[model samples]
Target: MHKLWNRIPPLASDYSGVCSILFELNSLNILYTPSGCVHPIVEVDEIRNFDNVFFYKSNLSDIDVIMGVDDKFLAEAELLVLNNPNLEFISIIGTPVSNITNVDFQKIAEELERKTKIPVIIFNTNGFESYNVGIYEGLLMLAKGLSKEAVRNPKHINVIGYSTIALGYKYHLNELVKVLENIGLKVTFFASDGCIKSITEAAKAAVNFVISPEGVGAAEYFKEKFHIPYFMDIPVGLNGISRVLKLLGTHLNVDLSEIEESIVTRTELRGINEYINKNVLIIGEPLTSIGIRECLRADFVINNITIITNLNSTKKSREIYKEDLFSQVIFVEDEEHVAKYISQADIIIADPLYTIFIRKEDNKIFIPLPHIGLSGREFAKMEYEYVGKMGFEYFKKFLKSEV
Candidate 1:
């Protein structure tokens, strides 16, 4: 089998991504597939405890699947709304079953919206693609459905595309907020908290800081509709943090010299004053890999860095990384492609599950940087630093022990 793997598994599909994006938002999110399809996420990828009523699995039966019964789904939706009447919107996320059945998700979504008099967003995230596409379309649907006409708040900002599972927890927002608040700019809205208020307040932000590829669609929407200036970047390394600050300061017209100097001061306090020259490989989604690659180069002074990932960035995301000459992004076609890079790397930093691709006897340094999308909650340490200043510091801890 071309897709069979000895150890590594396939990334979570699109419906999971869409669900993760909507996980924290105050909306009625339903997966339109057999009940079993929701298991991969609810038991593993999702950190939300049970008893949460907003999210549901449509519980399609053998007859419903055979007949393609839209009425069965609508009846369930009507009951959910009847119980949770204060919902701002409803989202119908699709999975592999829907794709195989060739269901008309859009028509059903239109019918649902018309019947309920609330916004119904069809994510169209059939299980064909990986989670990034889900996150991308999920946020895009969110922007399309929720963003409103409002006067812009000059110092206000929204951190889009940063959700649990793929990007770690919303505490990453706290790290960035600490940075933004120091420079007289504040994060007015962060969507990862599962707060519906963030969705409503999105239109007023002066800038939308896109943290992952998933947010690209939503950021573009804000720019086009609200005329808000947004740039795509994840705060990872020391320089990566500075780069984001520079992007934000330019838009908000604030001074960041004090903040930049303080980051250096804190980094120096960590006693990291060495240029670590080694062949290193970073793997995972483009969002995480790209951030770690940039962090390694600018912070560790490692020039021989290379990245391998299964996910590719948007055209605009590539442009964002074009100026990053320190490393290159390789899209892995198969396990062999990954084997080739890990074979060359003296050190590897990625999700722990990628260990399946490497040799156990090799004298290579493998640092555990667990991504929730890859390893689920088994390995991802939410407080262990995955973004911004704290992210770099956490990475530096690995350098101290392994490098």
Candidate 2:
């Protein structure tokens, strides 16, 4: 009853997040559930489902649940591996049905690996938790299973924890790759950007750029195993990217302040003085909302920024760029509480769906920032830039600061 909401749909579940991560890999993904469970993932959250990845749902019947039948699952997985010799690995994702029935996903994965002789990654993602949790688990598994122990390169860096579900990968990350390359840092791997080699050799990078909370687990794993260091911030806007380069250069004991500034920067402004002293509240995933806040405060026009986020990983992380800079922070658990905060803002920067809490008649301004976790396919098909110099320009549209 506490989780029930009248207008807003539930955010993408853990399995969807796990599936989004697996969607990028060259492996067969088996989501264990009853019938009709995979629709929301393919139809909504996963906008780039090309029907090429071996994605299947284990149609566990009522009797199978009662009997704990796993032989059929093993046989199906073995057959798939036998047929697809090019498969790199396999992913076993769980749903609410498996969670309630006390399914031992580890045992199932062990058996499947023995039968297929290929590595099997398991995400016991019951549908109850949010998608970022599943993504966090999936990426950590990839870090442990696929990334190899290799010699590190000082000029190489990997963009960790970004997923396709964010819906800004094509425009945002592609530009980011070019920017990092131009700065003399080779982007060795970008997680879940559909590069299998990037994932496998992720350890070779001298450092990792952890852009989201989903990458925390994998970043920590690499830090512990391969002794790779990481920073938790995306080079968002023009000023933001320069600050990020400085941060990276500091970590490697190199100076990038001497490097030419980004081509993009804060504009003279079409009209932002009205929002200068306004109380701005940014609602979205942790890293994203924080990046927006960083962008807004770069010129010091909007200092009163509040962040509402879903993941717990960012707050606990060290060396996160200006994590304590926010005026306030709220962990999203209850809808009513979120609405109460939404009503208090002079301006709100969040997905369009969140605007439902605020009436049009109200004087409050709503900045439409699309998050895949909030609206799924509603914004997936649309164009939204949330990375690099162009991303800041896209964000600048709502701020009325485009020059």
**Please, what is the TM-score per model?**
0.90, 0.90
lDDT of 2 by residue, 72-186 (tens): 8788778878888888888888888788888888898999888878888887888877777777777888888788888888988988777766544555577778867887887
Worst 10 residues of 2 by lDDT: 312-321
Off by over 4 Å in 1: 266-275, 312-327, 401-403
> Which tens-of-lDDT digit does each residue in 1-403 have in candidate 1?
1455556777777787777777766789888877888889887777666566477888679779878989888988988998998888898888888888888988888888988998888877667677777777777877787767877788778888876767776665577778778666657545565677687778888899887766878888888888888888887867777888888778888777777877644444322344266788888767677788878777766767787776534443344345343145676667777888889898898888888877778978887777777778787553476567677778777677232
Backbone clash count, each prediction separately:
3, 0
The alpha-carbon deviation from the true structure for residue 116 of candidate 2, after best TM-score superposition, in angstroms, is 1.9
Please report the TM-score between candidate 1 and the true structure. 0.90
Predicted structure 2: lDDT: 0.75
